[model samples]
Target: MSPRAQPRGKLANWGSSFLPGAYAGSYVNIGSMKPDAVIADLKNGSLNRSEQRKQADLLAKLNRGFLARREKDAQIEAGIEAMEMAFRMQFSVPDVFDISKESQATRDLYGDSEYAKGCLIARRLVERGVRTVQLSHSIDGYDIAWDTGHGDIKGGHARLAKACDQGIAALLKDLKTRGLLDETLVVWGGEFGRAPTSEGKNGRDHDHYGFTVWMAGGGVKPGYSYGATDMFGCSAVENRVHVHDLHATILNQMGLDHEQLTYRYSGRDYRLTDVHGKVVKDVIA
Candidate 1:
């Protein structure tokens, strides 16, 4: 998917694109406000304590009513989940993002880029019960910068890979040390891969025909590569895994059957993998 598709403005739109109504209200941009300020505001909002209690009581009542309906109402359940998450985050988010709490050696292991910091934050979040965390390699705040199409691929890819490699390595190592790697899934890839053929002098154009993605932990076999590109690294030659398959495998790792995990919208059900996806069982442990 194009980075342009991702909204840079409000969190609602972004959440809708990825998870629809499920996370719209739970959107928290760690980049926007300091965790301390967010916690403070949540505690000392315009509403007084009694009013807040009443509101919480009302929400609980509504949630019970929604649960009694027996319909798989994603919007209702998502709203309830969002409210609960928001409340819990008031206490958890601050400490989770505080990298200063990490040892100096751990900090050095991950390097010192915003992206690297995000990787560390991801580990912390996962350790604290966040199920999913995404860390992208983008020089700018947006994801489009990873589209390396122009100028020296050697130097450009090297610089980009250096930070990503260090951070991901550190993350995997940290998770393993804490015995979380077995339960946590780590996936690394881009929207598309660069073509093997040259673009200008050293750069390469986007190649949607074939690319590579790797998975670690979460039931995947360790140190085993599943597929292959041609000798020139242009296209997949065997054991091809489509993006849908990737999604299915990830959901499978999280104990969710991708086909069954659907949300109702406009009188129809939609899922992350749509109507297609087969779990690549060969890669599983």
Candidate 2:
């Protein structure tokens, strides 16, 4: 992302991993909702685009004096940037989130679950030329959603997979049919893998020693598996790709050189992959 167009980075996904760490005031959390529904004044359809900009200008003017007090106040700049982005989002978001416009077959492809809707929306966003999209299969944390399996690993996983797998499969199929798959990269997996051994009666504990992440499209070789953990799935026994390596490979796929892509802050340069990252070339097509 261009440092000059930082305000537009408001479109960045709110997920911690998705947001840029070096760029302060770079991200604003926008859910799958129209600007009209999100902005309080527009909820009732009273403020049109022109009126929204007019108010934004007025608000900016109101903050001018307050902003002049500091040479580089990220908070003040972020406020102005948010107002500008809210105006810009008015044009694209509403239409993207409205899946009612999609055909029944298309909808059924993703199934009729909340995860389905997310997958469908992600497809729509990609179809419209969105560069990156992330989908979480279930809720956050290890207690409720994907992190669980501590008590009834069998039934728990079965039910959760039932809720999410259809949508993911449909997204891949839909994107391929639409020809977006070749250009879009879809990543699926969690922060860490579940333990092979049981925690309670059937549930598993977190195992950071080894985990798996699968990538489809975006130049990734199809069905090309790399690296492997031991039989117990307890630790890496073969090619171990660090998170930095994964980050570098992803940037390489996007035509970026991880070593050269640096952001300067506090008199030092920082990299997304830091000082240690090697592109896993074998994973590339």
Candidate 3:
């Protein structure tokens, strides 16, 4: 999941928080509302600690009416569950982000960029048994991180590529050395690719029809390339994978059937791959 893509509303914790009788939710994030800051909060009782309990109490009180009426409320239950998960995470998550505990050689392997730091952090998170982690790189005062917009693609892409290349390489190496790669899936790519045809000056626009996503470990064929675009890379000409198809393939690799795994929401059956999606078996090891 992209930090830029997270919904900043009540549904924000939908993916990170799993509720009873809910579907498809995962682990908590470090430094998230109070990720990595839990210890300090507990020590001082600063806003997050004292204030959190107050909020939890208020929510329980509000939800009491629904419970008294013999009715179930999903939103209230989800919020309470999320709060408990966040509080419990403080114990295990803080150390996961502390890359300073890593060896000097390991630090050098990831490079010095901010993105590199994140790569190292991600590895640490995984090592500590965090199943999923998402890193989003951004430069202050800039709206876009990797999207090279209507600016200098040469300068922008080069810097981005350097940071990503070093970080990704180190992550793979570190995971393999630690014997975590085979079980941990590392996915690298963005929502879309840049258009080959620059709409203006020296920059291109977003191109979703044709893009690339790379996968490693977790039973994928190592050093293999799948699918292809046309000469101009304008559209996916061969073995095109839609977003839904991609979801299905990923779930399949994770040992789940996209079609079989369904969640009930709003009194309707909802599949992760939506209406149609099939596993691309070619990419599997």
The candidate that wins on lDDT is: 1
The better candidate by TM-score, 2 or 3, is 2
In angstroms, how far off is 41's CA in candidate 3? 6.2
**Candidate 2 Cα misplacement greater than 4 A, ranges:** 1-46, 60-72, 139-144
Off by over 4 Å in 3: 1-71, 141-143
lDDT of 3 by residue, 54-128 (tens): 876776676776666857776656665665665555545666667678899999999876667768878887887
Steric collisions counted per model: 0, 2, 2
Question: Which clashing pairs does model 2 show?
Answer: 149-203, 150-203
Residue 241 accuracy (lDDT) in model 1: 90
Lowest lDDT 10-mer window, candidate 2? 1-10
Task: Estimate candidate 2's RMSD in Å.
Answer: 6.1
Per-residue lDDT of model 1, residues 113-138, tens digit only: 65677788889889988777765455
62: Cα error in model 3, Å: 11
Question: How far in Å is the alpha carbon of 276 misplaced in model 2?
Answer: 1.2
Residue-wise lDDT of candidate 2 within 14-73, one digit each (tens)? 423422332232221223333234233423268777787788799988777788877666
Residue 117 displacement (Å), model 3: 1.2
